[model samples]
Target: MVTYRAYIKKDYKAEIRWEPDHPFLAGLARISFMTVLLVIPWLLLGMKAPELTPTSSPVSKSVITSQQDRIIEPSAIDNGLVIDTAYLPENEIFETTGLEPPELEEIIDPINDQVTEAAWQSVVVSKGDNLARIFSRLNLSARDLDAIMALGEDTLVLKHLQPEQVIQFQIDDNQFKSLKYPASLVTTLHVVKTDDGFRAETLTEELEIRIKHVNVIIDDSLFLSGVEAGLSDNLIMQLVAIYGWDIDFALDIRSGDHFSMIYEERYKNGNKVSEGPVLAAEFVNQNIPYRAVRYTYEDGQSDYYSETGRSMRKAFLRTPVNFTRISSGFSLKRKHPILNKVRAHRGVDYAALSGTPVKATGDGIVTYLGRNGGLGKAVILKHGGQYSTVYAHLSNYKQGLRSGNRVKQGQIIGYVGMTGLASGPHLHYEFRVNGVHRNPLKVELPQATGIPEEEMKHFTTQIEPLLAELDNITAKSGLITVNSHSDLRSSVL
Candidate 1:
């Protein structure tokens, strides 16, 4: 009888050996074993390993280096050294060696491949996460962060981290080897450990900006139609800003008005990273077409211009705030909603959700920034010689706006609110010429500087193709949704 211990100690080949006195099952088992042994050797000898051919992309983790006959030892390496192979007899193209290559000495900088398996780790910023907190979680000392910050202003961006922003790091033997922070979609900050200490550099990625086209007709609202036409909310806001000086989108956009645009879509490595500025756009408001193309000059100054070389920007913004409705218009004999009495309405009341930004209509200085008799939280601005504007009924003023403070056009001076005597959150806007009230909607706005005579030819050459593309795609050409999870940093530093 074969015991468990005895069976384990016995040589298995003996049990399978063929013998005429053995049982028929034992003989069959021996034949099957021999066949399997022979078949396995044959199959293994005939099989081939998969060949690794080079691809168009960069190789990761390892470099394919062929073994050479010669050896390179660091101890024997001399900068001015040269070896002569002439001593070997009759060696034309190659030589044979018996010795194996020596193991390489450590390099000063850890190459991407030599950094150990999965050495690089991505650290995600959590709520209330900062650089100190992130470093602490990685078991990194405060000195490491201080050393990184000491690198200079280029590394200053790492001081602030937003939630969900990824910070990549590499560690070797509990020592910080390198760190990479994405400053923006097109810019990355790299910190590498060096012999001199830590080195910081900003690596900027080239932006491949491709122009995307869109054409949509307003069936109800510009926003609704724009979305259906594949326009991103970002692009829609850009479109509104471009034509905002001429058209009040809140009230003036009609059911049939069509919008066309050619804007920028920034890309990296064939993948889109961010949305760029609108290159050229056109908005036909009430059958009146207003076309604008962004033109950059030799000095790097850029602004939007019309086909006739007229500047797209007006002296004053048509609407001071993005409001839902025009609660009241200018009238000599009107019934005040709060007072319930017939009075002269000297200004246009713009009803908006509370906290909507109220912008300055033009470049001006604040003449008054206090509550008037009925205009609560009022701000009065004097524009150069003749024009002056009034904004009232605000929830709050811009942080530091004061009387005599200079304000540029489109600067937020206050917010929409119902402070003293208003039915809803609204902005009471009054445009005056030499202290006399004028209809803001009907008042003629001054034109900005157009293309210079010297640059007009260049402007036409650059702008013609953009205009043609808009005209050609008069059909329903759609835009795309923006990538919301994009890097927010604007530049490298």
Candidate 2:
């Protein structure tokens, strides 16, 4: 150590001392102090640390062991909660500390099972409302409308649609899926999705062909007379076909001719849809009554027959005319306008516009087709055996028409004209048997063959009920008239 001395004032001199090596000792002291400062806190904190306590009660192990041994009583209790030691013991302390029982899943019901039916929107078509316009107003797509219209051509005719017809649509999720209509009758359409595509099925009530009769007096043409008598158009067509062979509807119908018919009227949903076929019909011409009945044979052939089972169809039709007016009838010792002499008029003449088609009277072979004497252009058809028919006054023959050509009955052979020694445009029709001229209108013609015998029994069974219904309608109509021409006008012809 180094020391320093100093005198402070002459009277009292004082000595001062200084230590030069104290810095080195000070460094060692600082290090020693820092060491103690760091170790003392750690040592105190470690001695004061908290300890973990036991979670289970002391009796838990005993209770668990007793349960496992099956020696614990049910009355054991701890913390005011009774312990089911017999089932769960304390030694097996239920450690629900971090565990939870499985959640009970909630049940849900199916949508379809609980769904309520959707409401249907209905619209009644007022006068002048059409399906297209209405559907457009409802914002339906053109493709959807087209699909509905494509159902059927016959089913699409809106002329039959009437005012106030109820139309209903089932809209699910704003899309049209079903439609229904009910007027005097009801019709339903169901739309279903299939593997191919969407399709519509039409469901309608069964139609019952019913018989209802009402009598009408003949006052005019048969067509008008039938309508006045409440006969449906379908029935009228049937009547015409029935007597087509015997009656030349274009000419032979007289004002006084009366008719009575029995036929079926079809009804669906208690409303009349149409009238079916005529079962039987009676026509009185010139005081002679003609009757025809519909008969079907086992061979599936249907024909009109007389009461005596004679076929109503003749072997040859009365005339070869097609939509023409009869100008004159057969007359003997009559003066020909062109010849200006008392010559025999052996055939009837039909007046029609030039170029009007003429048909063959029956199936036959063309024997001749050329000009001859006064019979300008002519065609001669030779039927089987002794029957032959001649057509004169033709403007031109049908294409490929020549001698030796086979022609079926009703086939067009030529056109009408004043070709031969005639006055105006007309057809000269003649019928001959073994070359002997006979009145075409008055000849007793042979009937067509009836249905085969084998089919007769089945035919009778099938057609009998239909015929009965038709007869019942005819009788009820009371429109039947016989042999009275005065009230009927000549306009009917």
Candidate 3:
């Protein structure tokens, strides 16, 4: 207890004092002295214990008497009997209480937690590893291997096992039950030991395709930007192919160019397996934005189109070979490089490596594919109508290509080479309409077919959402590598 004190002076101050023996409070806090006195009631009365609920599964008991009379005596507790609380004996309850008994799931094993897992042994195929060698390593019998080999043509795939392929099997009591070999991403070879012999079957895994978004702002080149955006080489090549018709990646790409697109990624067992085709894309090259969306008609043919239903592709490609530079352009009355004579330059010469693939600009028939006077070995594609293109200075033509064969657009028909009247490895390409020669670089290419007028509404309705998603993803997240994972549930079943 504390009390305040006041002293009268020029500077009055207050003081606090403690009162240990307070007069107003009496007979307080005598615990140590009253400890023995508290046990007087226990000495006069007695001790008792309460019953407890069983924490384990109850064991049922059989009784011939009433619930109150069925209580066992002390001698009934035998020490030799093993008590299993896991299961109850099939009998009535020893004591009939009015309250309802609890179920086995109410307090224990509520979810019926009983699961059996397979014991599978897996082996990875290394170099020079064959089926016989693997079976011998696993201590498998030769007769079983012979029976597996005799199962026919379906089992022939097992004869050739490539490195890194996995083989899994289940064994119990030194007996093989089943075996599996993953042949590819989509198929698995399964063999089981039947009562008669061995059975082989191929099982296919249904793949799940998910949409992935990537936005890239070019700092130096498209390849570097795509790498920064975490794109694979295959995906970058696909992107180039999608825009190869409108823009030449070799010469037209600028530093500030940016693009956004949503593409497909295949997944199995929740892990990404491979990449798929681009669905929709927007590329802004030198401040000019070009957008394309994939559209499929009822005939099962698919193509890329603009937002306004214009085809993104043209009748011919602008650049045929992946060249390093333009050595010569189409000009008239220009001094020749080798002869040093004023001559009419009719074609553009593209400098490249010797074996660089030369692509066909348009679908056409091969009219000429042999040596000319100074043009050397060449292939001329005669397109439908009055259009024709010539490829000169070839090293060697693509195999399986001959004169009078039909070639598709962007198909490799020959390779870049310096065969005749040339100084280095290059290609001299000329574009001709009717009989008049046109510059391949500046010639306005013809347009390809687009969506029909009747199908414009359908095309717009189907492709708009994909474009809108790509736009939304770009708007929410700026130019960076992002995997949106917006569940379109692409093809999962």
- What does the lDDT come to for candidate 1? 0.68
Could you give candidate 1's per-residue lDDT for residues 230-336 as a string of tens digits? 76556776777666556666567788888778889986644455675888776766666677788989899888877778776777777788666677777887878
What are the per-residue Cα lDDT tens digits for candidate 3 across 1-493?
1111222111000101211132321122243226435743332121100001121222221111112121222132354222222133333232233223545454342111211123556777999999999888888888888988898877788988998666876565566666778878898887777666677888889999998888788888686688668886567767776776666665678998888889999976444668968898877776566777899888888888877777777788776786767777788977887778888889888888998899898899999999986788899999998999999999989998999999998889999998988888889899999968999878988767778999999998999798788778667656542333221111111
Q: Which candidate gets the maximum TM-score versus the true structure?
A: 3
Deviating ranges (above 4 Å) for candidate 1: 1-118, 141-143, 194-196, 254-256, 321-327, 335-343, 350-358, 368-379, 391-403, 412-428, 452-458, 475-493
List pairs with backbone clashes in candidate 1: none
For each candidate, the alpha-carbon lDDT, in order, equals 0.68, 0.60, 0.69
Which 10-residue window of candidate 1 scores lowest in summed lDDT? 2-11
How do the predictions measure up, each by TM-score? 0.64, 0.54, 0.66
Assess candidate 2 and give its lDDT.
Answer: 0.60
**Candidates by TM-score, descending order:** 3, 1, 2
Ten contiguous residues minimizing lDDT sum, candidate 3: 8-17
